[model samples]
Target: MSLANIFDTAASAMSANTVRLNTTASNLANAESAASSIDETYRARHPVFAAVRQQVEALSFDTLDAGQTETQGVQVLGIVESDAPLQQRYEPDHPLANEEGYVFYPNVNAVEEMTNMISSSKAYQMNVEVMNSAKTMMQRLLTLGQ
Candidate 1:
């Protein structure tokens, strides 16, 4: 890989982390949400990430010499809802309760979501630091001739 590609890699990682954080926030926001039925209840959402790779070719005397591999970065495959069972509570007096006196709550766990948020934030910060370090290195390289 090249020094310039570091920025792209870090940027992609930051974007992926942003998606993760957004999904975690969404899950947390709906953690306490109630629904009349299990099907209607909001489920915790998670982002899936995939790595992208690029093939690089080296040339010698205008002829292809060898191949090299480069990582482009991470991509969000998709957001998936958790399959865990929803919370079922019996509340006959609740207005949204079903005919059977039951209410469904999302399967989101606050502690898990909070941990995900923290990890995502930390990963994003690390990516930012990487980008800044790359910039500093590039600047230093520019001063080498002086």
Candidate 2:
């Protein structure tokens, strides 16, 4: 890969991490939400990612090979809701309690959601650092020709 491709790869990774952080935040926000029925409860969400293979461009005679593998970068496919069952709590006095003396609550774990958020944020920061480092390296290379 060329030096300039570093920036593209880092940018795509940062975008994917942003999606992850947003989904984590959403999960945390609804962690305490209660529902009268499982169908009405909030479901945990997660971001899906896939590698985007870049199209191979024509190569010059000097560097051309009989066959070459395509390069890939990170990509966010979409967000998916977790299928975990809702937690049932016996809260007869709860306002949203059902006739069976049970209150259906979302399966979102606040601690796990918080952990995911932190990890996603840290990953994004690291990607930023990578892009910055690449920028610095490119600048240094340019100075050599001065």
TM-score of each predicted structure versus truth = 0.89, 0.87
lDDT of 1 at 102: 98
lDDT of 1 by residue, 1-146 (tens): 77778998999999999999999989988888889987788999999999988766544456666646465999999999888998999998988899999999999989999999999999999999999999999999999999
RMSD of 1: 2.9
Give the best candidate by TM-score: 1
**Candidate 2 C-alpha lDDT tens digits along 27-132:** 8888889888878989999989998977665455676565443565799888888888889999999999999989888888888898898899999999999989
Error of 2 at 33 (Å): 0.4
Question: Which ten residues in a row are the worst by lDDT in model 2?
Answer: 63-72
Error of 2 at 92 (Å): 1.4
Per-residue lDDT of 142 in model 2: 92
lDDT of 1: 0.90
Model 2 clash pairs are none
